[model samples]
Structure formats: C-alpha cells, structure tokens
Target: MDAQTGSTASAFPPGFPWGGAIAANHAEGAYLTDGKRLDISDGFPRGIKHEYDAVIDPKKCYPTHEAIDFYHRYPEDLALMREMNFRAFRTSINWSRIFPNGDDDEPNEVGLQFYDSLFDEMRSRGMEPVVTLSHYETPIHLVG
Candidate 1:
C-alpha cells in the first residue's frame, strides 16, 4: 500500500476535450418566431406538468421559448465564453429551427446560416465546437 492512499492526480491525458454543455430549448429562443415551428419542448408547461401528460398550449405557459435567448444573443455569449478560455462548446440543435415542421424537403436557410455564423465565431476565437443532433426539443409534428 502506498503511503499516500488518496491523491488528486488525473488519469486522463492532457487536452482531453474540455467544453461546456447547452440544451436546445434552454439556450436558443425564437421558438415560434422567424420561420420556425412549434416543438414538443415549446409545448411543455410553464411551471410543471403531470407525468405522461402533454402541454396542450405552449405559447401561453412555458419556461423556455426565451430561456437564455441564445438565438439572438449568441455573439455576446460566445465572446463571453471565449473570455472564459473555453476550448470547446457542446450544444444541441433545435430540430424545429432546422426543420420547422420536422418533415420538410429542405432545411430552413436562415437556420442554417445562423449555425454557420455561430461555428465561424467559435473557430475565430480558437475554440472547437461539438454539436448534438438532438437533445430534447423534437418538433411537435414528429409526435404524430
């Protein structure tokens, strides 16, 4: 047995992928704005809903839709993250933002452009981006 039984040494190698996590509905807003359609996340109840129950009307009561407003405020947020020396950012895509109706022949150009700009900003700041295809905000249309 070693003299020092407990140590704070790390087992992982250096530069082992450090980043932050962000959810779609929690970060990006504009849920029903622009060309985006409503998603299941948008329909979630304002305060709390019973288990196995759907949020009938989202527009009226929901905690998100403007949670952090990252959609319209990503530039500032990215800059802040850069200042914090973030090496990477892990965020999910808003299915509704990309495919408003969840089943479309083409993706929304504006939505694509927004993400492009976001990635560019991250790269410009010497940071890597890890994208998650879907977190929790699946388009409501897909439920059917």
Candidate 2:
C-alpha cells in the first residue's frame, strides 16, 4: 500500500475495470426542455432528507434543476472521464424523460435520441455504459 494514497499497487487482477456512477436526477439538468416534464425530484428543494414541497414552489431553489448541466455538457465531461481511465460508467435513465406522463402510450422520441447519443458518446470514449432503467425520480403525473 502506498503511504500517501493508502492504495495497494495492483490491488486487483489484470483487466479490472474502474469507473464511476451518477443518478439521472442528480446529473441531467434539462428539467423541462424538449418534451420532458416534471418528476418527483422537481419538488425536493433540499434533497431527500427534507420534506418535499406539496407542489413545485418556484420560490425555492432546487439543486437538480441545474445539477452540473451534464445533460448538455456530457461530451466534455465524458472526455474528462476517459482522461482519468474510467472503463465503465453507471447511470440511470430518467424515466420521465422518455415517458413524460409515466403512462404515455408512446415514448418521447427526443428523449430516446438524447440517450442514444449519450451512450454512443460513452462508447466512443471506450467506456462501457451500465444503465439503470430508472432511479427515484418518478414522473409527477403518475402520482396525481
């Protein structure tokens, strides 16, 4: 183990992959752009620890509203991840982005395109994407 980093050199076997993960609601920030609509995460002004507002209070600031701007800056961000030698990335698919109403008969095409591009970007950078169908951010329309 290295004294400074406290990490053993070659701790795992050869070909071991290293990567990072992120939740869609915590990264994607195009909130209502395109055909997307509000989801459960839209009301958490102070994260999951605090009580979510009964409705979206425009007065309160929500971090997920613009979290990292990853939705738009993913190319640059994925490049940075490649620079760090990340071989895999785990991320969720924002359910509401695809089915804005949760029960919609057809999916939103633009949303599908966004993810297709995102996954293609990762593959282009030699990063394998591990995708989750959904995270905690359910479409608000379903709750109504």
Per-model TM against the reference? 0.83, 0.90
Best by TM-score: 2
User: Considering summed lDDT, which 10 consecutive residues are worst modelled in model 1?
Assistant: 50-59
Q: What is the lDDT of residue 42 in candidate 2?
A: 75
- Where does candidate 2 clash, by residue pair? none
TM-score of 2: 0.90
**73: Cα error in model 1, Å:** 0.6
lDDT of 1 by residue, 100-141 (tens): 989999999988888898889888987898999998878888
What candidate 2 gets wrong by more than 4 Å, as runs, is 1-10
lDDT of the candidates, in the order given: 0.80, 0.90
For 22-133, candidate 2 gives per-residue lDDT tens digits of: 9999999989988989899877895457678757788788887888889999999999999999999999999999999999999999999999999999999999999998
